[model samples]
Structures are given as structure tokens and as C-alpha cells.
Target: MKKKTTIYDIAAKLGLTAATVSRALNNNTKISFNTRKLVLETALEMNYEQNKLALALKSGKSYNVGVIVPRIDSNFFSSVIRGIEEELYPKGYHVIICQTHNQENIENEKINSLVNVQVDGILMSISNANLEANKGLNKLLKNKKTPLVFFDRKKDIKGISSVTIDDFKGGYDATKHLLDQGCKRIAHLSNDRNFEIFRNRYLGYRQALLDNGIEFDESLVIETQSNVQDGRRAARLLLDMEAPPDAIFSSSDFAALGAIQEIKESGFNIPEDMCVVGFSNEPFTRFMELTTISTVDQFPLDMGRKAAQVFLEEVGHTEDVKTTQNIVLTPELIVRRSSSKK
Candidate 1:
């Protein structure tokens, strides 16, 4: 391999001080634009790789932000990650992403690892296990004061900020939409009840039924794992009941898709026999023509952007953490063929 070029080599070639080259590489505002451009060109020509770790150590500013997500395979969270990258990359920030696989131990370990890396800040969407009453992640994050921001799956930790959608309202709107379509005996296909967003959704569903003078039927509610298989199983169980639900409001689009599959397999016509509404307006929802009421465009992208903005503001001291902010964006309900009944 060719000898790797260093900043000193670039500085020597340009007859400028190494400090000027360093400042230019970092896009330091103090350096003149022309000089910065010239130094950057020289560094590139010499194949000089910028040493981020050395720069971080010298300034005590990593220019790196860590994000912990449950999983990246989901459309919702992935979009949020994209949003975060869009907001931070332009401002000279790098993101390190880690997944917890929804395990408490894994989540704890990831957070600790990020903290050890001296990251400037962390943005997290904790797992279901972390939300359990026995989990100690809330205490751990709070005690560290590590400039943590929670999005989507957040717990109420003092001094930490969060950006999320109004999950309760999303639940209410989904249930209400089904009811408006003449669904009296409707059931919910729920995810892990420990997650605050899911719990809030359940509450909203119950409240909407109560407001509409519909009896809250415990037998009609089916709890399932956060996936399509569980949704399919729950649909089968509900369909086998003596008085099957006329409609279903699922907390996840994956679950709703499963429910639709099972319903169709059972020879029940959709909308005419059973209507389905799903959350998280995922791309597949529109493609498949499923009627769903969803919250947040995708928590990952929006949350990521908002979380980075928060870190930027906090670092600049333009925004104070003393006044903790909980920003909840509104959800939209998309009417489609699946839930419509003439």
C-alpha cells in the first residue's frame, strides 16, 4: 500500500501551519473560506484521512452522536434514523447506531458502550424490556446526565427530553374511524402492553368506545407479540368467537396485514364482513390498499432529526434542558378501500 498521507504532509506541501490545516479540515468558522478550500484540496490530493478521534480528544468534542434503536428492519424506526442523519450530517455530526433486539441486558450494554466512547450525546428508543417496572434503565440514564433524548419508546426520566407522536390520539382516531364505519363489535390487536405508546393506544381505544356508548368488552381484546404472526393468530381466535368483531384496530401495520390475510383465508369478505385499520402508515399499507390510521410519518426519521436538533441546541446553549420539552406531533388517518362500507 502507498504511504498514508497526514495533515503535516499537506501543511508542508501548502506551506501553511498544521493548525491552519486542522482548522480547515474541521470547517472551523475562524478560517477563511479560500484558505479552507485550498487546504482541503491539498489534503484530498495527498489522500490524507482526517483523524476524528485525535480532533475529538483535543477539543473534548466528538462531533459524534450515538443512536440506540430496538431494530432497524422496521419501516417506522428506519425512517426516523434517516431523518436524524439528514439533520445532523449537514451540521458536521456523525451518528453511530446500535440495536438492542428488545432485550433489557442488551439495551443496557449498548448504552454503556456508547457512553464509554465519549459520544457528545445519545438518542434512544428503548426496548419493551427496558419499559418493564423492574428495569433500571431510567435510573441509569438519569444518573449519567449524558444529554439523552428519547423518541418513540420513551420513559418519563427527569431532565431528559423526548419527541413522540400522540399515541393515545392515534388509538382513539383508529377506533373512532372503525366505529364511524358501523363497527360496533370491534377488537384491538395490541403489542407489548409494557410500551407506553402501546398502553396509550389501548387507553385511547377504550376511551373512544366509552364515548360512543359502546360496551367495553374484555373478551374482544386480543394481546399479541409485535408481529404479523401474532396478528394472524389473534384474528383466527377472534373470528372463531360466537360473536366475531365487525372491525379490528391494530397497533402495528404488520399485525394488520396478518389479520387481513387470515380474514381473507377464512372466506370472510373485507369491509363487508370485517374491516381492518392499522397504525404506522408504512409504505406497504398504501401499496396493499389497507385502510389504516397511523401516527408519525416514521418515528426514526422525525425523531432522529428532532433528537439531533435538540443536541445541537443544547450544545449551543440556545435551548435549555432545565425546561424539559415533550414534543408530540399529531397523527393522520388515511381512509382507504379496506375500511370503507357503503
Candidate 2:
């Protein structure tokens, strides 16, 4: 096996002390610039890799952060991650990403694992399955004094910071847009009510209907997963009704697409016969050029940036002083062809 180079090897090669090599490698301002440059060049020549664990032990910080999301493939989550990385990378922090697949057990395991590895902080979007109070996760973080920031999907736990868009307003805006387009009977494709984001969105939908003097019918609402198949099934159910809905306000873009597909297959003219609105403003929404489906822009990138900032602030404080911040970004409703019946 090949031997790995170390700071000691660099020091020996450069005829310098190990302490000087270490300080130079860490970019300590105490070390002279010329000496630091020489040590760096020597370290590079010897292929020396600084031991992160040793530095973490000395500095009391791993300089590594863990990020947990339901799924990395989703555009919203991916963009949020990108924004987080963009903000933290320049601040000398490394991010480790974990996906939970929307399972609570997996989310718990990931949290425990990241804490065990001595990460400085954790940023997460709690899974749909984590509907209950995350007492266990909270206890673990509190014990470790690790800063935790929740983005998008969040649990209502004290001493934890969270960054999210106003989902209730997003839902309200989407539904109101449909109502303004003269959609008297609007069906809603909702997700599990256990999640606050989905629940708030449903509330917004109901409120909009009431405000517009339209009766809210339970039959017009369908609980569905945010996927094309579920959206298709939900749309079919609505279409099969004795009096089908004239519009749909979906909680997710993928479901809205599915609904659109089902509506077209049923020979319904969009906006004329059935209007639709989806959330998240996914890229494909515009490409498909389906009737401009009104959508809520959650500004996932900004969500990520703010979540990272919260983590930084929490970690910056002393362990004895814990500060929590709840940041809610405003959601913007983008009017598009899908819901423009006028």
C-alpha cells in the first residue's frame, strides 16, 4: 500500500517545524505570507492532505453541515440546495446532502447520523411522514447543541429556526385566480393534511371559495400524492362527478400536469372547459404551453439562502445562548395561460 503524505512529512522535507506547517496549511495569519506560500508549495509537492478530524478536534468545529430533503430530484429541493451551497461554500463550510424519500424513520436516522459525525449544523425539510412533533430529533439536536434549520416542510418545535414560504397565501392566490377566471366549481388536488404546508394550502383554498361566495364542497377536494399518476386519478374522479369542476387548483406542478393530460384526453378545452393552476412553478410548466396554469413561486433559492443564514447565526452564538428565528418568504402568484379564461 502507498503511504499517505502528512504535515509532518512536509515539515521534515522543508526543514520546518510541524507547528509552522500546520499553521501555514490552516492559513493562520500569524504565519508569514512567504513562509505560508513555501509550506503550501511543499505540501502540494508531497501530496499532503490535512487531517480534517484532527483540525475539527482542535477547532471544535467540523466545518461540515448536513442537509436533508425529501427528494433530491425535485426542482424545488434541488434549487434550494444549490442556493445553500452557494452561500455556505464561500464561508468555508462544506455541505453533505441526505435524501429521506419522505420516510420519517429515514429522516430520523439521517439526523442521528449527521450529529454522530460531529457536523456543525443541520438543515432539513421534514418529510411528509414526519407529521407529528419531532421530539426525538429535537432532543438529539438539543443535546448535541447542533444548530438546526428547517426549510419548506417544517415541524413546530421551539428553539428551532425555519425558513418557508407562506403556503396559505400561495394556495389562496392560486384558488382566487381560478375564481377570478369565472371558475365557479374548482376542484383542489391536495396532499396529506398532516403536513403544515399542504394543510395551510387547503385552508387557503377553502377561504378563497368562501370569500368569492362559492360554496365549498368536500367532494371537489381529493387527497393525492404529488405525482402524475395520483393527479391523473384525482382528475378522473373529479371528471366522473355528476357536475365536473370547471377548474383545478393543484398543490403540485406534477399533479397539475397529470390533470392537464387527463383533461385533454377527455376532450376538454383548457381555459374554455377546464382551467388549472399548479404550485412550485416547475420548468416544464412553461415548456408544455398548456393553458397558463397559475402557480405560486416559492422562491426556493431564497429559501435555501435564508435557511443557511439561520444556521450560520445559530452556530455563531455561544452554546449557552440559543437564538431561534422563523422566516416566512412571500409567495408570488404568476398568472399564465392555464388559468386565463378571460
Best by lDDT: 2
lDDT of 2: 0.88
TM-scores of the models, in the given order? 0.85, 0.85
Q: Which regions of candidate 2 deviate over 4 angstroms?
A: 1-51, 128-144, 289-292
- For every model in order, what is the number of clashing pairs? 5, 6
Predicted candidate 1 versus true structure: per-residue lDDT over 252-289, tens digit per residue? 88888889889999999888899888888777877765
lDDT of each: 0.81, 0.88
Error of 2 at 29 (Å): 11
Task: Residues 1-342, candidate 2: write the lDDT tens digits.
Answer: 999998878888889999998888877889999999898888778887777778788899898999999999888999999999999985668999999898777878898899888888889898853544555476665596777888999888777789999999999999998888888999999998888999999999999999989999999999999999999999999999999999999999999989998999999988789999999988888777546566889999999999999988887678678688999999999888888878
TM-score (C-alpha, index-matched) for candidate 2: 0.85
Candidate 1 — which residues are off by over 4 angstroms? 1-49, 129-139, 142-145, 289-300, 318-322
Q: Using alpha carbons, what is the TM-score of model 1? A: 0.85
